[model samples]
Each structure stands twice: as structure tokens, then as C-alpha cells.
Target: DAMVIQNPRYQVTQFGKPVTLSCSQTLNHNVMYWYQQKSSQAPKLLFHYYDKDFNNEADTPDNFQSRRPNTSFCFLDIRSPGLGDAAMYLCATSRDSRWQTYEQYFGPGTRLTVT
Candidate 1:
């Protein structure tokens, strides 16, 4: 479905060696984002793309990276993961253009383990 968040739920994660997950929306929202969530934790914005515009959280680790070369495709690249890196990777998008952060939907997460 368009204008919706797929896989809005996820599993608990443990300390991690490396893990990567994904999300996509058919709505073609101009802004797309990836969030980090720990077990029993709140979702945290890792990074997002505003139609080829890349924005990263100040505290986000260097191990985390992203790419959006086209309108409908984006990727999350985790160079190296640590125990603390074990968390949900959420993909989301917003309809608003001209750089606005609005309400978003979530995707089912990929659980990771650090062992």
C-alpha cells in the first residue's frame, strides 16, 4: 500500500557484530529515513534522504551509512557493527517536500545479535 509504513513491528535485539535491515514505501514520499531501536527502546533517527539530500544524526556512528541514488531506491550500509549497534533499522518517508519532517510510518525490523 502507498502512504503507509510496512513492517511496523520488530523483535528484541542483542549486542551485535553486524546487521542490516530495510524499509520502503510506495507513496514516494520525498523524505526517507532510517531509525535505530533497541530492545524495549524508542525509535531513534539514524539518517534520512530528502530526494538525494542526506542528513545524519550528530551522534550516529561512523559505522552506519546510507545511499539514495534514485527516486525509488535507497540503501543502508553498515561498514562495521558493535554490540551497541544491535537495534532495529527502520525505513520511512514523508509526503512533504521542501524539507519538512512530518509524521512517518514504520517497517517490521530485522533483529541482530553480536556474537
Candidate 2:
């Protein structure tokens, strides 16, 4: 089945170390998004890519960054890991249309643990 895939379902990193989470999809969707979700809190939209265009949320911290080199793959880069940054990182893809509403499909997510 064509769907989103996230690597290294669980990751452990030392404080101040850099870590990268990856996501890919076979669905060939035009829009890809990254979200940070903490337990018992609402998921926060970090950024998204619509084709070659990149959009970042105004409140997203500078520590969070994303890269989409191609349509099928996206990367989330954390410049410095912190204990407070430990959370589930989700990757989602959507097909936007003027004719109909499209739903976003999310991957299982990558759980990050900062020591």
C-alpha cells in the first residue's frame, strides 16, 4: 500500500546533540507537514512543504527545521536536543483540491528521547 513511512520509530539522544528524523511517502502527495506532539497536549504544526515551497509556523522554535529534497521524502532536523523536546514527531501528507476536501494521512511517528 502507498503510505507514509517514518524511520527509527524510537530515538535516544544526548542533550545538545543533533538528531534527524526522516519521513517518506509513496502516495505522491503535493503537501507534506511536520508536527510536534507532546503527551496530553495538542499537536503543533512545525512546518510544511507545498511542492517546492516551504512554510513554517510563526511560533515554531528555531531549533526545529525541516527539509524536503524531493516529493517522496522529508527530513526533520533538531539542532540541539533538549529534555523538553522529547515528543512524538509526526509526518503527514495531503492532497489539496479546490473541488473537494482531502484528508491528511499521518505516519506512525518517531518518538524522541533526550537524555
Candidate 3:
């Protein structure tokens, strides 16, 4: 069974403060995800990694950072979270990146609130 776990399902931080959100998977899927979803908009892929290879979206801002130390873990770090940075940070995993179509297992997400 594929399952994703995200710690601190709800997080609150002050403006310009730094925060880190973690995601871990038990199935050890090769592809780990770090994306942002604001309100009703679709989840935007900030960056992702399969093992050690990473791919960052061209439009992703520098303030958003991601790290994957091993196959099972990933982290999203916001250097200086602004008011607009408050959003639902979602973590997901898939088998691999080569497939044309694949299903992703998603964590419940960590909702970041900035005040």
C-alpha cells in the first residue's frame, strides 16, 4: 500500500519567518513531490526529485526550496514566508517519471498560515 505522511497538518508562522514542512512515504516511491496550492487554483509543481536527481520548475520562486536526502524523505523549506506564501503545501509520490500516465499518492497536506 502507498501512503504519504505529513507532519504538523496545520502550521502557523509569522510573516518573513522561515518554516520547514516534511513529507515521508512508506512505500519508498522513487518520485517525491513538493507543490503549492493556493485556494482554488491547481497545485503548481515547485520542484521534485527521484532519488538524487532533481527538477525545478522554471517559474518557481527562489524563496521556495526543497530537499530530498534519500528515497523516502523530502522537505519543503520557505526561506522568508510572506503573507501571500500562505497556502496548502502538498506532498505526493509516484512510481517513476518515465510513465506517460501514473497515479500519485498524496498526503493530507500541511496548511501554512501566515500572519
Worst 10 residues of 1 by lDDT: 6-15
Clashing pairs in 1: 7-107, 7-108, 15-114, 16-114, 17-114
Q: Write the per-residue lDDT of candidate 3 for residues 1-115, one digit (tens) a residue.
A: 6689998899999999899999999987888889899999999999988778989999999999999988889999999999989999999998875656478889999999999
The candidate, 2 or 3, that scores higher on TM-score is 2
The TM-score leader among the candidates is 2
Quick one: ranking by TM-score, best first?
2, 3, 1
Off by over 4 Å in 3: 97-101
Model 1's TM-score against the true structure: 0.77
lDDT of 1 by residue, 1-115 (tens): 5643434244333344344454566777777888877878888888988788899999988988888777666667666667667666667777665556477765565555554
The RMSD (Cα, Å) of candidate 2 is: 1.1
Model 2: per-residue lDDT, tens digit, 70-111? 999999999998899999999999987657759999999999
Q: Could you tally the backbone clashes for each prediction?
A: 5, 0, 0
The C-alpha local distance difference test score for the whole of candidate 3 amounts to 0.91
lDDT of each: 0.68, 0.95, 0.91
